[model samples]
Target chain A: MNWMRTEMERPGQREQFQDALLRGDRPAVEEMIRQELADYPYWRDELLGELTEQYLEGAVPFSQLTVLAEAAAALAEHLPPVAVCGSLEGNPGDTGRNFIQMLFRAWGVPTLDLGADVPADHFLDAVSGQGIRFVIAAAFSADDAGAAMLLHQKAMERGIRDQFDLLICGAKLTEETGKKLQLACMDHRAAAVARWVVQTWKNR
Target chain B: MEKQMIFPANRFALVPDRDEVFAWLQCDAGPCRAAFEREWVPALQLLEETMTPVAVCAQRNANALTVFLTIGKETEKRVSALFQEERYILGSLLNTLCDEMLFQMDSKLANILQRELVSEHLYMAERLEPRVHLSPETLQADFGSLQSMVPFARVTTSGVLYPAKSMLYRIVLTGESRTVSALHDCARCDQADCLYRNRKHESLREKEKLPERELKESTKRRKRLVWREEIGIPVLLSSNASVDDNSEVSRFMDYFKLADPNDAAYGALSDRVHLLTC
Candidate 1:
């Protein structure tokens, strides 16, 4: 649908969407969203990306942002379920993990959220018990990174490194670390990772 | 004996820089820019009315500088409540902005130290440790007493800072003759958080002693390591402030009535008005 082109052509469409969402004009927002989905379903990721940007900018409240995320998730409901879980230490906020989950859901991949402060063994448990082959780990501070890296090492120790694909996202997932771990590192945006997941799944 | 000094909220301006805030909003684009202009004022007003910046500077021992910072009790309460209400995104953004504002204030403080105190080099506490000779665990343990310097901040049982929005730093001053290296070589390090820690790299030498087939497999797995550009939004350290329902910014939705919410200019004007009222 050439989402960028459409966004460029209709300069204020995103703002309109955000204003309607903020003003509690759900019907109007829903109608606009429906139109976009019906006409350019391929641009679902881009549309959600714009909404996430608004939420990050504080233009939309958390409730409204969740609603948008759910809406995006509903669009890709037909896709297969892909087990996903994330854990962060010390940080109570789960916005990054939630956003990634929503993006995965939008791509029709059902995610199993393990919540925060997850230990390395829990990730291995998910893979072994749930038959899930993909795992995502996130860390904000050095402490959180310590826990996340522990998870990576545990996965390796348990002989699951080659069995499952570990995707690390967050401030601590540097290029050097990703290279050393032999895992994929995602950008902060859920859309970017979702795109990678979609392409990888399709290619596979 | 350890020494500490408290800086009142008035000592530093906690308001965010206009350009940085706009940049954060990604307002350079046409649509987002229009929305930013509309919403900027009210957000600024809310910030000014609610925020009270406070800082504490202390030296745990003779060599290290520790600073504890927060935007006072009221804002912390407000942000905490927002999180409880499940307005996590808004709460997170405000929390992050406050941290950035504190950092700006810290930079100013550094400038003052360099100009007035004539310090040669100022090293940020987080930057200095783990990269230098000191470990975070050691510093975190040593600076445990500094928590009492600030009223709103505390150290958790895990030795991590609490009131997640609050910042605790331990900057150090060195003579010009000393060359400080902030970057850590993660590949060689055993630090758990070191992203560059190559588990296989360390074991490769040991694996060389294994059978040819096992070594071949190990080498193949190592060869698969590909570096991709690090992506993702920088994670802000989460603040664990308790929620307060009486937050002044809770009714933030009512502060601005977009005269034609769809109109870019109108939205911009409304935001400017909100900022102006502050």
Candidate 2:
């Protein structure tokens, strides 16, 4: 096995903090991120996101993942709380990462984890109880979209449809379903969606 | 009886690259501008010392194909020891490290399977791990099937593989011969939006030398056909003159029990296959 591995290809660090993050040297990574966030918010956000992807791919260790989460949490401190949940039917190899919540953190948004296989009533509760404005629904399989649609209909029934933004993400969600629910069917890339949300939130 | 093969120590034993492990550990390579490497040695040593790779492969013709690989129970035993000693960080890192260690064996394991498997047009598309590509029940049954093959391994009532590190890779086969590729597993993974996902856009003409006409054959009717083994759906691309897809789409969708035509599942079916006439 050793012989099969060629010269170890060590990648160059894109920023001062990345090498520290990868080593799971959280204190150093945090210090560097704290410094960068003072001026280079975009740089800090993008790099942390890039590293989280590596973690998801199993390239990095658990410690590195924690570093990424902590760093993202720093960026997200000023943002309002949001809600997150999805079916248990997808991302089976997730290894307890609960990455959508992490991704919400990465987007610099705090989240309330409603737990798995959550129903429409649970989402409505997060909205009403938490005064949450954005509800991210994940549908790994198309069938999982049903819960989000139900949530939307319930929101409308409660006369609160205009109060919150409903986004359905995951690989199999379609515009047709989004249109029917009058929801934003989105790509699962958290960075882009996060950017849009931040701008919208600021304006609102 | 199905052919069951056990890998010898040499066949299964592997040491993954120290650099890979180090980089993954996020160690320093300062002059090369890397993280400090020494910090990771104890952990890697713990993993290398503890893991004993054992593998068993079995398949029934056309029905099922599986290769079961596990770092013997000792690896997890040591991890549990670390946890009991309140070395939770090390324990967690060890757990993740074992997965990295196990999955790095994917290529060698696939090679072993290829050597033993007798086939014609059938070729493995990718390794589909349970829970990732399959449901718990499907994996439960797959494990039950393996009970007779890898008797040393065990499966819980809930379909969790035993030895904690044990992994079952289902051999996914496409109907036609594909260019045997070293395509990274990420390339084939269905998570199109995964930050780590890699997509290969090589032309069919370049990769397979498939004559465009033959692969995109339209039955004497002028509608073109596109197919993918994973989707098991035929995307019939008809121009303004022809229908949206083959007449078989509705029946096939029903047969597959797919959600709906407007669903992302069908969109994925279209995306996975190329538009031939274009």
DockQ of 1: 0.04
Summarize candidate 2's per-residue lDDT along B1-278 as a digit string, tens digits: 66566775578657655544444444323221122233246667888787878777666565346667777777776765653343434554566577667766665777766655535445765555543345445565666656765666775433456665777756655555654432235433434443322211223333577565664452223223113434554554432211224455544433222222233444555343222101
Off by over 4 Å in 1: A1-29, A33-40, A46-85, A89-115, A122-133, A141-146, A152-164, A171-191, A201-204, B8-11, B37-52, B60-64, B72-96, B107-134, B150-167, B171-278
Question: How well does each candidate superpose onto the true structure, as a TM-score?
Answer: 0.52, 0.51
lDDT of 2 at A59: 62
Cα lDDT, all candidates: 0.51, 0.53
- Report per-candidate DockQ: 0.04, 0.09
The candidate that achieves the highest TM-score relative to the unseen native structure: 1
Candidate 2 wrongly placed segments (more than 4 Å) = A1-80, A85-100, A106-108, A115-121, A139-143, A146-163, A170-172, B1-11, B18-103, B114-278
**Best DockQ among the predictions, by candidate number:** 2
lDDT string, candidate 1, A76-104, tens digits: 44333456667555544354565566556
